[model samples]
Target: MKILWIDDEIDLLKPFIYLLQQEGYEVETATSGEDGVELARREVFDLIFLDEIMPGVDGLEVLRKIKNENSQQIVVMVTKSEEEDLMKKAYGSWVDDYITKPFSFNQLLSVLNRTLKRRSIISEQMAEEYATQFRTFSEPADYLEWVDYYKSIVSWDLRLLDYGSNDLKVLQKEKKHEANAGFAKYIENNYRDFLNGKGPTLSNNLFAYAVLPVLKEGPVHFVLFDSMRLDQYYKLSNSLREFFEINTEFYYSILPTATPYSRNSLFSGLLPLEILQKFPQYWSFEEKGQNRFEKELFAELLKKHNLRIKYSYYKLSSIQDIERSINSIVNDKADIVITVINFFDLLLHSIPGRGDMKGVLDDERVLLNLLGYWFPLSPIFEIFKRLSKKQRRIILTTDHGFIRVRKPTIIYGGRSISPNLRYKYGPALRVDNKTALLLNNPGDISLPYEDPSVRFAIAKEDYYFIYPTKPTEYEKEFKFTFQHGGISMEEMILPYAIMNPR
Candidate 1:
């Protein structure tokens, strides 16, 4: 570890430097705050020791400059003056540690040792905890449900990564990627089984199994937000307690996690093929524009069931539409209101197209932070707050989750192939059989067949389908980008929650 010490009386600190050296730390000295700031700008240090009283560019100023340059660097403030106000001011400026003028060399060494040692201990603990759980998680038979197991493991890994243990975080991330790869294989083996009713409840049956049972108590507003990840839902659930008591559940999203398929299937309580066959005009597979009109299909489903006890369907893809939905909640006649908020999907799509958004969400941690910041103030919450004052219930859910795609598998097909990163549908579609969930017969999975020769293939884990044309260019552009509509735990396992106002 390297330590940068900035004090006007640097010569007096030689004994302390000798102690730190004995403790196996490299020490660098700067006589003035100005020099210290300049050195900080040029080089990276594990920690900085800055004097509180310096001639040119005082210690407080230097601390501010250092923090502004690199907020993560640990800074300790050393001051000769024992004024309480000075200590308070120094703390306010975000100093990691404070030392008085008459402090012993042992005390200084103790502070440095303790700070660095705490980080080391945390790293070790994280590694040990993950290692212990890793063994149990890796057992083949432990995972009865692929989606739930994959989510549990990813959630643990994500939490470990947030603990900021550098070495352990790297290990956990690799484990997560490995788990995702295995999950992809599991999906390849079992997705068809699930879709064919040989496995568990899937996207089309999510509402029937999860939401309908909860609705027996009272009105349930099944709000299916588009592109909501499990982690994002977990974060948002914390803030919901103030207004409602929430019961959480999870279900698998069908292939093509996009709005037109997964979401439409979700609201209509039917698969894409069923919807297309039942109401052909309402289903538009080739349309690329926003599917705002798809909410009507949900209304149609309710009507078909003869359970028309008053309901409304709203799709909010913009701020204006969100406001409209919020205002619509004032009408208390509707027993259930299904609102599909598309902000996360919009944000995901915008990241690659907008430079500022790309910069902000470049890192997964930053992306999670952005979701946390946006969720509490979202229009959905505004609508929830309004509805909480009424005699009703809210059921929050999503069509699918998203995964940050890293590996691209090259797939070849005819020109008729639908160009979706997570899945493809066409005749003669070629992909690694092990890497995809091949539906050679679409009818078995309740999916539409475009032609007699047509078939659909969904990417089973973190792998996204990349066309052979301009392979390198497309791979470079799409790698590490968030995508969905396939079979990973994140993309398939969705939140189905029942909440009543507190």
Candidate 2:
């Protein structure tokens, strides 16, 4: 590594420089701030060590000039002074790190190793760890084990994202596919039982089980961001830690992992067929605006629990809506506030190759990188920030997650079939039994339909359903785009978090 050290007493640091050079570093010395600034401008460096106190054009000023020129430069401030104000000033000016004078050679070496070799070291360690774990891999036996297993995969995926080899990523992908197949089988076997009251927490009873107990604590603000995956939630959780203490758990989404099904079940505390039977006015066959009666359903849910309290509900479709209504959402004095943010759902279903999304939407990692870049500036982040200050108890979750479909499964269905790419429902639907779950009766799985003959075909793994006619055309439009309404680990297992202001 190439390093530049700036100190007024350059002769005094000769011993330190010799030690660094002996450790395979190329070192250059500057005796004054003027010379240091000039050298920094003319030459590129892996790291620059600047003295915090100097006689002429002190270290802080030189640090500012260097940062102004190239903000990405790594500069470590070294000083004999122990004042907090000076250290803060150096850091405020964007110093990469700080060190006090009379430090040992090992301390200097430790800093250099951290600044230059951290990524590579971490990457190597993670690769070894994963390789070790790969030998002992086994299929999860149940949903609870599956939750832990899926979480492990997601954790590795995120870490490998920043520091993993291509081979490791491919291996992880294969393992995820295997897990999805197992999860699909598990669901096929136990889903009906789950709905029959043998499964863990699900969408229909989430509000009753998770939210109602928290209600007695204090006022609650429940925010549901549509189509949020576990990986995306991990990214958001890192940012939320600054203002709140977050406790997150996993929950299962009901069959047909789509908004009209899962989200409606979430609010109404009833399965799709139950909703149709009990509240026909709120249930509909149409996909669009199916969630329009969420408030009414929520009211009904409240009544069922025998709890009557004022609650405000808001469904925001865009950033503009969040910007315009966030104040009201934060200021409302209701016993509970529910806000459904639709940006992530819209992001998943929107067409690709649009504006900045020219090449991002097709790749999950790139899409997540885009989200990481946008989250801090997003109005949704602003809502969280504002809500954190109010000390309100907050519950956060999503209707369902999505998976990027890579394989296409051909199926035959009438024109009345639902338009979702991951699943199809209508009369006499025909799909390969190996690639999907062909439910002969929709009502058997608690899906809603007036006719008893209507059936459902839900795709498994990374498959998307395409019609027999013009299959290529359909594949071209849907391939690699994220989709829901199917049985996959990403779709069924979801993140449920409770945040309290710190």
Candidate 3:
């Protein structure tokens, strides 16, 4: 492979060039941007490392000219500046990859492998690394171990998507499925103990554990993206990292991981049954009013903690709503501001008609691609930029996450049962015990219901509950759609983080 190293200080790169030459790669050097662009135009090279700063024409200009001439030319920017604006400029010029200055020869070779030999070399490396990491995998022994295991799986899931083979993707998906099965079994056995205060920080206490300590430091801007998965948070963090220094940790959502139950628990700092019993007037399970009282519940939480500080709340479903509310949220004289963005939840619910839903069922990477396409163009990008300037402390989290349902488990329930596909609650609920957790007493898990005979059945793994009637037809309709309120790592293990503006 031929590589062109374009740097104003070309002599300093001779060691790297020599290392590449020793590895049987042709190395060419250009001392100026004009010379580099001319060299790139004259001969086709496998990779071009263009320095960011040059004497006559800067890196951005050279990048534009080279790209204008041959749009397919692979240009990797070598830069010393870590400024956001400079990186954005390079990206705007369509640079393929980047390497910061003061990097070693191995780092340059890694970038070369990533840019030129990504499919063949990097994929093999990732597969070997993943195999080595999980060769002796065992079911997590406790909640803390489960958190670590889940994080490693999420990390591999993202890494494999970037630099692993198709066979490796399949293998990782199988491993994730196995992990989910074990996670569901763990929850089935110890969930009640968790409710009784024996496990990690849960939904009802997440706000206290994640926010109050930060509140002691300063005012907080709490942003909640409803129904966001851990992997989605990891994707969003790249954008968030530019504005804030983030510290992320994982917590567990309560049983029936839906907005009404888990989100209310988050704000009110009380279990669902406790919410229903203590604040019946504010609690509602109706679709439109499910989380209508979040502000009230949050206020109740603050008061329960004996705090009389000012606070503001905004719940936005559309981009226009968020755009309009930003000024008010930023300007409000509140010690804490809470904004709940429901667009992600709306996106998940609206994607059943999309052609890629079936692909999502077969390969989870499809959903990641969908998120990747949407996030860059999403309004949250602008919102984050706006808030980052004024807000010093930020708390980011979600109520729960959705899992793409691959298997439709037959469940028997009446029309009065809640229509969520992942969990059902009503009188005389019957489902395959292997696929779901059947709770005759909802109070066992602190889940609320009006009637004494009301039972809850939460689907596990990739299973979604379907009524016995018209089972086949319903299965086709809801098969690959994302749903929550179930027992899976995606839904239960959630991302909680604190961010300080940089």
Candidate 4:
């Protein structure tokens, strides 16, 4: 790593610099703080050693300038002074570490080891831990163990993304896929029973399990960003950390993991079949513009819970709709505000169909950059910024997440089959059984279907179903684009967070 040291007593520090260089650090020296400040601005250094009480520009001032250039840059204050005021000033300037003068090589080495090399050390340890623990989660875990396994992998993925090497990241990703493969099997075995309240909190149980408890604290703004995955939430959480203390967990979206099913289940607090039976007016399964009935369903949920609460529900799709909604939000007030933002979901669909944005659909880094660019323009971001100032409890979640489809499983189905890339249903549906779940009866899993002859084929892992009629066209369109509505960990698992003002 690159190192820069600034001190007026350069002669005395020659031994230390020579030692660092011998130990494989590229060390540079500046005799004055002014020179050091300019050098830091001109070049990139992994670590900086700034002398306190230096001539011209002073150490504290130089430290401030360096921090202004790059807040995350690691800078250690090396000084003879133990004075409280000077040390406080150094700390205030974002000094990453400290070392006193009249110290030996061991002391300096200790500081360097802890401060400069910390990320690499931590990354190595974490990668080793994951390697060691891989086998425990490699086998099929039961429901609770599966969640715990997913949690471990998610945590490791987030950390490894920050510090691990490319090779380690690949290993972690492979382990993740292994876990997902096992999870798909687990879901196929129990998903039908799970929809009947056999397991933990589900999409249908969200309002009762998550919403009411959050509402008891204060006013709430619930944002459901459709097709948002866990990796996406890491960036979002960082952006929001400055405004809110975040509490995070997740719930499993019922299959098929699509907006029409999972989102409806979330708002209605009932499975699709139950929603249809209990409130026919609010049930508009897979119909165009069906999300328009969400407010009515939400109202029905409040009444069913005997909640005497006021709420404002909005399903924002167009820019004009968002403008109006923002205006209404700024002017009016409600106890609960629910907004379903669909840009990510739209992005996922548009990518495979439209070539302009296709390059980002399969690359995680590019996709994250696109998201970073889009967040500033997003109405949900504005809502978060506005609500941060108010005493509001904010919730950011999604109906379902998505996965990039790599393997295309060929199938044959009638024209009545659902057009979702990850799933299809019809009497003629046929495919290799091991690639996905082929349900002969929709009602067996509590899913809604009009015809008795219709069956379901939901893709698992990275597979997407393709019809034999349009092989070339389907292959060209959706080879690596993100899609949901299947039983992979990405689609089934979702992020649920409660944000309190910081």
Most accurate candidate by lDDT: 2
What TM-score, computed on C-alpha atoms, does each candidate reach?
A: 0.73, 0.80, 0.79, 0.76
For candidate 4, write residues 1-502 as lDDT tens digits. Answer: 8999989988988999999999999999999876786676556687999888777788888887667544556899998978889788789888988999889999999998899676567667876887778745446456777767777777676566446789988888788777778888889888867777787689999889888998987788888887888877866675566578999878899988988888888898878888888877766645586566777888888888999988987777765677778867643478888888776854443343567465675566557645544554466667787778875778889999988888888988778877888888878788888888998988888878777898989998888888888787888888888789888888887779999987
lDDT of 1 by residue, 176-238 (tens): 677777766766667667776776667777767876676666776767777888877766675
**Model 3: which residue pairs collide?**
none
Please give the CA lDDT of all the candidate structures.
0.74, 0.85, 0.83, 0.79
Pairing residues by index, what is the TM-score of model 3?
Answer: 0.79
Ranking by TM-score: 2, 3, 4, 1
For every model in order, what is the number of clashing pairs?
Answer: 1, 0, 0, 0
Can you write out model 2's per-residue Cα lDDT over 1-502, one digit (the tens) per residue? 7899999988988999999999899999999997887676556677999988899798898898667544556899998888999888988998888888889999998888787675476567878899898789888777798899889999888877646778889989998888898888888888888988897799999998899989988899999999999988887676677678999988999988999999999999999999999999999898778999999999999999988899999999976788899899999889999999996845543334466464666567666655554565577878888888988889999999989898999989778888888888898899998789998988888889868778999998889999889999999988888789899999989999999988
Candidate 1 error regions (>4 Å): 1-120, 139-144, 289-293, 346-354
TM-score of 4: 0.76
Q: How close is candidate 2 to the true structure, as a TM-score?
A: 0.80
Candidate closer to the true structure by lDDT (higher is better), 1 or 3: 3
Query: Considering lDDT, where higher is better, how would the candidates rank from best to worst?
Result: 2, 3, 4, 1
Clashes of 3: 0
Which of the two candidates, 1 or 4, achieves a greater lDDT against the reference?
4
